[model samples]
Target chain A: MKLSKWALALGIFTSVALLAGCGSGSSNSSDGVTTVKVAWRATGKGDSMYRIYSKKWIADFEKKNPKIKISLQPINASEGDYFSKLDLAMKSADTTPDIVNEDTFILPADAKAGYLEPLDSYVAKWSDWDKFTAALKKGSQGSDGKQYGIPGTTDARGIWTDLVVTKKAGLAADWAPKSWADILTAAKKIKQTQPNVIPFAMGVSTTNGESVSMQTFEQLLYGTGETLYNEKTKKWNVNSKGILATLNFINQIYNKDKTGPSLSVVMSSNYGSTIFQDRIPKNQVGMAMDGIWNTGNWSKDGAAPIANMTKVLAFNLMPTEKGQKPGYVTMAGGWSWALPKNSKNKKAAWTVMKAMNTKQLAVTRALQEGTLTVRDDAAKDPEYLKKPFIKEATQALQNAHFRPKNDLYPKVSIAIQQMVESVAAGRKSPSDAAAKYATDVKGIVGDSNTDTQK
Target chain B: MDASNVIKNKPHKTQQQKTERRLSVWLMLPSMILLLIFFLTPMILTVVFSLTNLSLTGEAASSLHFIGFQNYLQMFKDPALATSIWNTIVFVLFSAVIGQCFFGFLIAFMMRGKNKTFRRIIGLIIIAAWVTPEVVVGFCWVAFLGDNGTLNMLAHNLLGMKPVAWLYTFPMVSIIIANVWRGTAFSMMVFQTALDDIPQEVEEAAVMDGATRWQLVTRITIPMVKGTIATNIMLVTLQTLGVFSLIYTMTGGGPENATSTLPVFMYKQAFVSYQLGYGTAISLVLLLIGALASLLYMKILKVKI
Candidate 1:
């Protein structure tokens, strides 16, 4: 009996160990080909569409290139968590993906860490490199004087105003403010005309950190001709007159004008849903300072598909102060595809990236995903410019400023967000907030490293 | 006869004893080695890493400058760090102590004399929630309590009132509700086991003496489950102190850092701010708090075994 029990235990243990071994082995050898792994973020609408589109692309690519296979790993985490996970995975060669989707802001920092490969040589050899625009090329270049990634899609930020509300407020249906004063005056008029509607919507809550900093604050800062970094001096810039004026304008919006949603509502991740699904369709938000991609959700198959959105809503270029020649300013950001330094399949990854950036592919993705392409051919394509909102956003791109493409830009952006938020909440005056921001930026990049030339 | 006795005892007995001792040591070696490798090694590495200036960004720093207590010093200076510590303490005291343990014992006591079918149904319902994923629970709670959520919809459409932003106005309370909903089941199961172990005859004797249900419960049942309650409190307190998913998903330490607990703060510092050394310092402090809480609970419980 004792011998029989011992034999039974050993058999059970052997079977369990074998099963565990098979589980891991099967995952590695499912397709009998070298799988090139890729990681990218998946949002609510983008995930479903991208999955369907990429599957088609992958099948076609695999048919031509028989030896190579693609395993697209979609991470459905928030932007911050996605970056953290990707960074952690890149720390080890075994876990690193062959290709990574990175934000423009983090590309320089990632390159500095030696986590990403410089693609300058690859670009030099590629015949299609000239198809990319100059601004897009500059945006992808790192401080090491080497290009680190291929800029995929660039986007512009602007105000999405309800035409009906604007008309009610005695403003033209195509009202485009030329200065800070014009925006405030329009907001006040809308507030009086539509008592129940929020006249302006600006995000101040920390929950949507980078979005608020880039889309909301930087839009205003650049409109005033102040920027986060002064490239001429290679220093962080925080104590500019434009920076202080932008802070005061945000404070007035929150405290004095009371034209926007409360700070809490602005900060919520569901703020997008509030504007798109609840507020805009319901005509409860007069004007929303949002991205060009808002129209993506108003299409026939969108989450909140409003058929009248084209007539009831209009896009306006976010106006520059004093109606400058371009007449508007915008903050532009984009995503890029880069090869990790440790990726064993760097050559294969570059080939896949090259195929993905073909003029046809770029135009198809830009139209279907509502993304503005960085390629000149894709941007100027008749199919792209035919869309009314896209036409307006493209115009804004002419005056749009990219975030400081420095390694310390992310930290500097966070400091700017916090300073703006503090001012908006009436916790600090504009001068005080700018002073605090200057101190924090000085600490982050060092005092001697920054010059506010403006 | 003496020769025969010596022959019988000398070789086999010594060999058997030596073999048994060797076998026992060999049996324990694997587990001991595994514990050292998995637990002790990482712990030592964390301690060492906390002292250095290693960062995710891989910025240049003077290597391993034995900064003594400089990291800890910096932790105190961080405004976010102090707020996180306070939030953690409040979360542990309210959600773990009063919400989970106290309410769990009350429910357990009430169900002890109830019908078997009813008790099973109620227990299953609570367990179902406890087994749900933390992130799912957070999302559900946010949907229920958001500004234009079900609660506000009810307040506006049915109750004829202005909508309230539950998450914005009371971030901590929202998290507490979610944590309590998920965690109370554990305490309930613990108390159930302890209550079952108590002899039924003692309760019968008290009942026959015409003692009221409340009186008997307070006097007999309360004292009987005191040790179990202490143990449950300690376990749950430690578990809740490390909760990151719920708060991270729901508030992300926002509405002005209203709900930033220690673990979330550590994550923000390490991942968000890329301050790896300072984050590790916060983690060490969190570990110390957990250790102190466990020690205090053990002393109070005073289990003889």
Candidate 2:
């Protein structure tokens, strides 16, 4: 009896083990078509736009080529966390996605790290390569002179001011500052006229981190003709005269209390969604140094629809230091679609990337999402040109510059942020803060490798 | 004749005994192997990685030279690391020791004979806060305490005052409040169970000897639950030492790294700065801190077990 029972148990265990094996093996090979996984940012599960577009695009591509399948894995984390998680996942070959949506700041870093594959071979064969602007193309080039990713869209930073608030301060309805002094004077006037309303808003807290460094500090620095790193010399510039001046300007704005929101209010990530979605629409803020995409949140499909956005709001070019030639300056950066170095199905991934960068797809995405296209054809398309904000932002982009793409940009940016925060907090004089920043940057980049242009 | 009988008996018993012992060891082997592979291997890898300059930047180092104590030396030189370590120490002392334990014990002591319904409701409320997602909790706190947030709105509209930036001015304090609110329930639950396990007879005997409620708690109840308190302190200290989400979501370790603990700093280095080696080194230091804390607690408790 015991021997028969043991035999029965062994037979059952073997059958169960075989069934498990079959279940695991079913997902491995399916009809000889490899499944390529692609990851991108989506707002949430409730947003059907991404889902619908992805499904239709996949179906169309599959019909054209029946031997490949693409699986879309949409990530819903915030921008920062999404990038961190994506990097973590991409660390291993087995778990890496075939394609990824990368931010402009990270693309160069990832390319330098060998996380991305050089797409020069593919770009050479691609017909649409010539359609991309030279500057936009340069944005995707790594230090090794190889193209790593294809730029999808770019945007410029500008002043988003409330016309009503400007008028309340006796400023012009079409108020546009031609110089840094003009901006400060107007801000002071607004503060005096409407003590209740915040006169100016710029992000300058560590919580805001790179956003503060880019959108606020770099916007000012670039206008002053100061760049974070000198590409020619391949060294970081922390002690530039323009940087000190920019620091002083930030210090005056915050210490003098002539700005829109408090340091804390300006630093919060929700500052964008909340100020634009709730506060600015409610007429609480006078001016915001924000991206061109603010109008996207106030259109008919926006989170808070402002019927009179064009009339009530005004867009202005961010002014250069003294309103010199190239009167107004702006900084532009864009996100790209990159292929992981370890992607199993490179051809299929390349097809999806090509589809994503097509003129039609780019225009549709730009129009639907208010992104500025990197491709010349898409940029000049009637669909994009018809959008008023797009036209204005595109004109502004002519003088736009990008952040120095360096592996140490994130650290350098953090140092810049700390100095900005110190100035905003009234804890240090601008010159002192600038000196400290130079020292800090020198420490990070090493003395031999750094050059501070004073 | 005796020697022959003894040899025969030993041969007869050998196969059965050997089979039984083999089966028993085989039954325990799988679990032992799992513990060694999963738990021990990763820990050893972490230690090894901590000593190397293995960053995510994908640069091939000229050499993987073992520079003994170099990473730790660099940790001391990093301003952010020093600030984070200070913040961690202060946070542990304030939030865990004073906020969670002391206040938790006080509430539990008061509710010892209070209405059961009140106790249950309070317990559920505290647990609810503890169980809420860290991100949601961070958002709620930011909404309540931020500039132009609910608190500022109330201060201006209802109290007729100027708005104050709670998050910017008092970032560490704001996060400490949030951490304390979320973590106090754990201490409460621990103390509650420890109190329940205390013998009623001991308390009754103290009462009969004319001991007051405070005296009974001080002398008898506290001593009985001392071990639980020690364990709770060790656990919560380690947990709080590694808390990244709350501060990241709320302040991003901002207002000049005022609220940055070691974990946040380590994460910013590893992920944001892409300095995996430096970050791993920081993590190793954090692990050492936790271990030292546990050992200190054990020594103080002097628990034989």
Candidate 3:
């Protein structure tokens, strides 16, 4: 009886192990046709249209290239999860997708990791490459001066204002603030007159991620007559007067004057959604330092419809500290298509990328996703120019600044976000936060890679 | 002539004993191999990675360098690590030690004299939380506790009070409650089974000896179930120490590292920051803590050998 029981247990264990092994069975065909795997972030409120466009692009590419099969791998996740999942997949050759839709900010780090293939050779041969302007072309190049990705869609950030609130504050209907003081004055007036409505919306917490850094902090920092990175020295400007001034400005808005939203609202994870989707359309918020894609939440096809949004809303270039050199400040960020180095079907993947990068697809994607076009031709397209807000946003791009393209940029950006949050929460004075930020950033990116600005 | 026959028989008897010992080892081989593959191998690999500079991307991706003790040294300097360790301890203490064990035992005691139908209904109700996926539980709590969530709406309408962002104001407490809700079911069932197994004669003798209900429970019932309590606490503490999905979904370790427990910290370091070596070191610390908890529980229970 003991022998029979042992045999039965061992038999069951072996069968279970065999079944588990069978569960991972994948069909690998040695057929003539090449299958190119493409992965992209297709989950979110705004990504549905992009998903449809991507599918159509894949279908068109497969049709044009009969020998290559396109597999659409839509990542149903948030931005953070998508990047981690893609990063994991790219670590191994067996699971890495051939073509990946990468955020432009991550290009330098991803490329340095040897996950990306330099596409300079392909871009040189492709005639349509010239359709992208110098700035757009620069967005795709890595720190090593190698073009490793194809820019698809980019967006610029600026000041968005509700004309109704501006008028109520005795500011002009066409309220274009020429300097930092002017913006503050307008906000103060709005607070005094319209006590119930929040005068401005700006994110600063770690939960806000790049939204706080890019839309609010960077805009303010750049306007204070300094840049975060010294381009010539290739070192981060950690201890800069510009950064301190920006922190003070945040402290002013959030803690001192209380013109911005309450700490509870700003600290929440849904601060962005609450600001744009609920507050802006409902006219509960006045001025906001935000991206150009706010209209996507309130358009006729949007999740919520706001009647006559264009008539009620207006936007302008976020002004410099005193409207000094370069006059106004805006920041542009976007996504790109990168070819992974581990991909087997490089040629087929390039074909798919090329098919997706056409002017028509770019324009359609920009229109549906409510992003600024990276291609010069697509930006000037009549259909795209029909939207007045897009025209102003395109104009705002003339003074736009890109983030510091470095491997340690992500860590540095988080430090900046923390600094802003500390000031916003009244936990630290601007000088204190600035000092701590300098120390923290120097710790993250070695001291040798950073410089103290005079 | 008799001695020579005995020596020859002894050699045959020794041969039979040797064969039986060899068969016993063979019978244990499968379990030993499975443990080695599933648990021991990964643990050894984590230790190896912890001694090096290994990251998912950037410089550490293509090249790995052995920087012995460097990852652990850096972890000591990381301010977030201190906060994460404190948060982890608080989580385990509240969620497992006090919340689950005390509340679970309380409910078990309340239902001790109940009928079968009442017991089954209460069991199903509590087990519902235990059986629900962590992610679903997290989402449910988020909806019920968010700023504009169900609780806040109800409070606003009923009390004429301001809405509270419970997760923001008290992230640790909120997560502890959610965890207790999910885990108390296990403790409840275990304690109930243990209570039932106690001999009826001992309890009846105590009752006949003029012992009050409270005295009987304190002096007799708790002492009898001390072993089960220790086991339940050990299991729940270890399980709660590694809760990532529920906490991550609820708060994402923010407003500003307020809710970043060890597992969340490890995840951010390993996946988000791509620092695999540093994250592995944190994982080893977590494993050591779990091992220490088990040992401490065993010692407290005075379980010999």
Candidate 4:
């Protein structure tokens, strides 16, 4: 009886002590100075770059506005964790940061949650707002037709080819496939010659999140003349020939031809490193459906310098299904700067935003981070044009497609990732995966909000 | 005069006993109040949240509505949830019950009457993994099991074999090994302490009666420390069921949801999907499973309360 009573008492005491420390205090304005809480997702080497940039930006802002202090918080985590952490922090007024670097894909959802303050009024006052590309501005606009963020950079997705492997497969060094069949023919030949190398690499699993959607699945799905979302109907498109054909494409590469990387590698969380850091450099991968930033990793200033990258590696727009009208398709995704709804120092936060989202900064970031320019002025900058892949990707941006910026797109994107993984793993057939995807999408957006492509 | 004094003393004595009982109840008040405010309150809130359509966003958090078992009903239809439940069971069975308790006990049993220096070294090594922070352990295992990791390198150089992605091909088994590697120290230490308490005379008598090694362990040593075995299993199983960061860091429940356990699933639903209501409902299921496992151990051990 004594032991039971003691255990109960100990349990209760420990729990209460934990709860008593739950609430955290937010920054407050004092006599003359206001503190602005600035937060961004910085993982791996990006943390140091963000830190350096933020320090300079903060110092510049504080010099101009002496009464305001910048409290920069760098969340060192993966992109997925960063999103969830930012969302959780924004749920409460006390924990919310003043300014955050929001993924453009999540801008609509965050705005819907009332975590983000619409920047329409601020953008209307800003002089350089008109300098941003219309497509980028649209990417940051919420479903309610309100501007929620200022986009930083947009990345164009395409196929990265190793000329060495292509030449070995008896393909021309400047080979650019006009259709899906042409790409497959090359992959087949590479498999026959190299035997050990992965003929093609694409993220086909839930492990890589948006990478699987933009880099692989969407690149293919858009070429089929169908999209995940129907802008005209404002409903997600599922159960369509386009989606099944996309899945079949994945199935053929993974199962029939076995030219793709092992499904297990595709499903591994760190598989991106294997493709970028190992396979491509070793010329062990023939072709890869990846972003333009992939080549940026091999930039002159980067950790690895593939000497004469322009000679060894080449890129082309992902071709449409039958090389039909437009002939090629690409999808654009990017990050944005957003203000939290409960920011204590909104004016100061706006100053930070303006400081960070400048044409000069855009040019610098494009060169430094290997990101495509989001602003028209930055795209024309000589420094930006000099970059290896930037010139080519900027031209492809005209043919680029943007994902649906609705609040449900994040969940829908995850469902697409799951569908790709299931089919790639041979756990489900293309038809079964498509069916499951349709059901998952319908459940998320409601059946009334979705439509069959037919 | 003597009779009147005796009656007055008896009444005073009874009053003193009543006051002592009242004091005992007062001593328990702070604990009861703490339990009501902290433990009971959050559990009740979870139950309430499980019945609603609350989410991180999308008109749900602003105006949550009661859906009455809708989330629970949907759980049954989710194939991924079923896979998570199965993975969690496999993880607990392998990592906790069989791996930690049985193997740890065997190690402890073998170490009896062994060299003190050797025993201390082995104990310290095992305990080191447990004492290290969970995230560090996770990263260590990733490096050890990665395609280009230590295990693969050793296999390539030593055995003349090709490198393999250990975490991908055997996601469940890999994590189980990691959990066991990190957690078996607790069971081993506990069982070793229990073994020390066993009288040496009884074991010597058993050996004199011609009892073999296997028979001695099964018939004598195990029966003697049955209580420790039961308690160790209960503790280890509960701890393993709640593992999140280690698995999340290593695999993030990937290789196609093959390593997603209950906690990982709950986190994905609650935080990733932002479906707080559904995630809480799944958490309650995890809670129930933990309670059930504890109860099973208690019943088998004949442990009361």
Candidate 5:
């Protein structure tokens, strides 16, 4: 009787294990065609740039490659959530998509963790690989000195101003600020003119996620002409004049001047959409120091779909502090097509990826997503530059700074975000926050991997 | 009755009993396996992960190792954890215990002898909130409480007041009110059912003694339903402790972690910061607090019996 019960228990355990295995079993080739799953952001109140491009590109890729069937897995989330979900999915063989739209900044860490497949061998043979910009090509390189992805889109940050709001505030509608002070003066004027409307809005809260790091903090930090990472010494610039100045700048707008959105609004995780979809269209915000991609929202088929977005808004270059060398400043980042290490159809995914990155599709994608093409040929294409907003946003690329794509950037970014958040909330003064940031970075990456600067 | 116990005289009954027992074992095997695999495995894994230096990504992800009580120790040093715990306590104290229980009982008491139509209308409104999805409730509250939201607009028009950022300035107060509004329905229904079970004569006798309304409530009714109130408080407190989406939507634990509760703090650490071990350690602390509350409530309930 004991033996029978034990045998039955064993049988049940095996059956349950088999049952669980089949539930999440990977769907490999069955009907003589390999299925390649592609993931990209598509759903949200914001722009459906990927959705527009994916619908057409999927058809084109499948048509070109007869033996490969492409499956589209559209993750509808913010940048932070999208990548986090991707990381979760990539941890398992069954959940990982064959081709994922990865942020270039995260590729290094994902590659280092053995989550993504190195794509160097595949890219080397591709004839069009040479057409990708060198800096952008560097974005796809992993910490192990291997290529993990191919850049699909690129973007630069600048000021997105509402002409109506600026003109009403007695500032020139197409004004170009020469220095940091010029921007502040404009902000003050706008604030003096319109007491109810937020004069200058930039993300400075934890809820804003990487946006606080890339768009607001980096834009200001890079403009100070001091970098967070010293590429020369290979150590993080923990305590620096640039960081302190950036924090003080945030303190100025948010705390001292009270020109930015109220802390409540800035503290919202969903305020990115709120700014573009609600505030800007409603003329509640005068200006935003943000990315080039938001202009897509005002396109005819875009989310907000303003009738004359270009006429109403200006995309001016973010100028450096004190009008230093390389007088304007901008930060560049974009998405890339990467394959997970556990992806079953690596070659099939590459084939689909190559098809997706063709010159024609790249131009269409650039137009749809309000991003610059990573491909040199596509960047030069007239169709990509036909949009006036894209043409103007392209100017920011000349003086742009890409984030240090490495193993520690992600952790370091959190510290930088906290530093900015503290100042934005008036919880810490600029110097104290910078000092605390130095301590936090030392805690994260060790004092050996860090340096202080004036 | 078992075949062997009731009809032991038959020789074939013993064999038949063995076959019946085997069949029952075969039937229960699936659920037993499922419970062992699904429920017990994750519980065990969470305990293991909490004791290790596990991260969601980067170097530690691929090579997880045991780190003892380091994560738990880190919690003591993390000011955010203390802030979140205090927020959770304040939230549970004000929103669940005081606000929901008080308003729920008050509303139920007020509607005791009302007309059927009035009762049905009030009942539907309360139940509607309960039936609605948490995310939808979150969005509704956001629209109602946001700076450019309905409340501000209404106040600006009606009271001629300058627009006040209700959610920003009073993040905790806003979420507390929203939680009380959303959660009172459950407490109301519990109290209502308990109040209904009370014999009408219990209250009538107190009235016959010339007791005032408040005195009648304090002396006779409350003492009678003390056990039910204990059970209700325990249930609501647990429910309110787990509330993530509502506060997440409204405040996102922002304005410098002013409104971050335990669950929200866990989410930020686990998902946002991608510190899996640290997040799990925090969750274990949360579970400990919950278990203690349950024990305390159970003791109160036992005292009444």
Candidate 6:
């Protein structure tokens, strides 16, 4: 009886240990052929369509190099979840993928965390390295002065008008807003004419995360000719005339003019998809201040594809505050192809990463996805400029601003979201919100690190 | 005379001792190991991690240093923390304490001496709601209370009323009601078992006297199941405090963070902002709150052991 009990206990222990052992990572290499693992976001409807391009890129690469096999690690999640999950995965050599479809917004943090490998050595040897514009190249560089990634596509944010509603509202579909007043006037006109449709769709809730900061809030702040971080002073612009003016503009739209979408619709977690796929395509929105990539949303093979794209939507430049020195303004955040530091197949990974960022592929992705090509040559390609919206979006880039590339940026962004969200919710006045923002940012980066402007 | 017999029995005595030792080891081994790995280690690590400036990303992520309760201090200054605590308190009080417990006990009490078929039918419906996944329940409530959902549709068609924005307008009320609906079944089932265990003669004796229904219940039924009531409350309170999925699936702590409870706030901090230390501190505070509530329940109810 004792022997039987001992035997059972040992058997249970062994089975449990074996179960634990089963979690060992799979083989990436076999029979002299390397399998390079690639990680990218392929979750939502519009995002999943990017996989069609990636699949073709993989097939073409495989045909060229039979010894190299690409294994795709598609993460089906929101942007924030993807960032966290990718960081968790890349923390260990056993789980990290070889190639990564990285957002440049988080590249500084990732590089600073030692999760990404510097690709300067690889880029120095590549002939197409110089084809990438200086600004685009700088966007992919880490604070350590190391080239961390190759720019995939950079996008600009602007005003996207729904002609279906523009015509209904008695507004000119072809008109470009030269100032904040122009957009608000158009929004009010739309509001008066079409009571059912949303006058202006802008993300302001924390649920929309960076979409509110970059696409909505920053678009206005950058236009005010104030940088989020002072490049020369090397201190964050905690409170400034530009910030106050920007918050006042947010106040005007959300409170004074009441042109933005209802707080209920704007505050929901799925507002991004709601505005992009439903409101814009369903002709329920008059004017949408959004990123350039929304052009793909209404394409033939996009998320909410409509019959006549040109007839339905019109892209216009986001003009500066009162049409300043740089007349139009836009904020650009580009995605890039990065190599994980813990990648097992380093050589094979570089080959796959290179294939992912070619001149032809960049142009194709830009046209298909309605994002600006990072490469100077690809941007000028006749095939790329075929889309008229793409041409207009490119002009917005002439006065584009990039987010402060630092580790503290992600933390600071939360404070900005809170400050902006509070004002939008009518919980605080614009001046009060800006003052709170200054205090919040001061707490984050310390007193000496912040610069206040009157 | 027994010296030779004593020598002969020595080997058997040793054998018996060895067998008894093996028996205990075999019985306790699996559970002890499981407790160490799953429960103890994680608890200790969470406590340790809550003390550090450990981040999930950036330069701070790679090298975690002890910040000595700085996260705790900083948490006090955060406006979101205050909102989350208030929301959590209101959610727990209404949904669990008053809503679930009250309705569950009422139904269970009402059915105490009722027909067998009636009890089973009610039981089945309640269990069905409980068995459905939390996410499914969330989605169902969202559909039912949504602007163009069944509830609004019925209200519009029947009463000629405009479709009300239920979730957006009243996030807390919406989540609390849905949570009560989902959790009442557990409390009901517990109360049913407890109520059934009460001696029939005791109730008969109470009715034999000149006692009203309310008097009989307050004096007898409640007194008899005091222990079970306390235990049930403790269980449901802790369970409700950790509710993440149901609320996350429905509101996503949205409409400008109005519905963001402690769990939602912790998720935003840890996963979204990648502030692991601050998030861990929030979780620990949440755990303490749970512990404090349990202690309070046990103390007020005077539950023995």
Q: Each candidate's DockQ score against the native complex?
A: 0.25, 0.35, 0.35, 0.30, 0.32, 0.49
Indicate the worst ten consecutive residues by lDDT in candidate 6 chain A: A43-52
All candidates in order of DockQ, best leading: 6, 2, 3, 5, 4, 1
lDDT of 1 by residue, B210-284 (tens): 899898988998889888888788889889989998998888876556788999989887887666777788899
Among all candidates shown, the one with the greatest TM-score: 6
Model 2, range A1-454, lDDT digits (tens) per residue?
3444554565556555645654433242367787778787765423433633567788888888787777888787655567667877777677788899887777777777778899999999999999988887888877677888898878888888889889989997767899989888998888888877778888777655577888988898888777778888998886788898898788778886446576666667666666777778888778888888666667666567788787888878899989986888888888788998877678888987787778888877676566687888887778788865776797798899898877677667868878998788776789988888888888778887777565
- For each candidate in turn, the interface RMSD (Å) is 5.6, 6.1, 4.0, 6.3, 4.6, 2.7
Residue range A1-454, candidate 5, lDDT tens digits: 6655775777687677757775855568877699988887664754464555556666776787879998777887766677678889999898889999888877888887789988888988999899898888888888777888899889988888888888989987558889988888999999999887889999988877788998988888888888878878888886788888888889999888888988667877777877887889888788898888876777777888777787888888888988898889899999888999988888888887888788887877787777788888987887777876776677778887889867778877877787888789887889988988888788778889988656
Docking class of 2: acceptable
lDDT of each: 0.79, 0.79, 0.83, 0.84, 0.83, 0.84
Query: Rank order by TM-score, top first?
Result: 6, 5, 3, 4, 2, 1
Which lDDT tens digits does candidate 4 get at residues A149-245? 9998788878889999999899987799999999888999999999978998888867677778777888898998888888888988988999998
- Candidate 6 chain A TM-score vs. reference chain A: 0.93
Better of 2 and 4 by lDDT: 4
- Ten contiguous residues minimizing lDDT sum, candidate 2 chain A: A44-53
Q: Which stretches of candidate 3 lie over 4 Å from their true place?
A: A1-29, A45-57, A168-170, A188-196, A262-265, A305-307, A425-429, B1-34
lDDT of 1 by residue, A335-454 (tens): 888999988778888877788789987776666556688888777788877654877887888788888878887767667777876777566788988888888788788889876647
Model 6 misplaced regions, further than 4 Å? A1-12, A15-25, A46-57, B1-18, B158-160
- Each model's TM-score, in the order given? 0.87, 0.89, 0.91, 0.90, 0.92, 0.94
Residue-by-residue lDDT tens digits, candidate 5, B274-296? 78898899888898888888888
Question: In candidate 3, residue B261 scores what lDDT?
Answer: 94
Looking at model 5, the pairs that clash are none
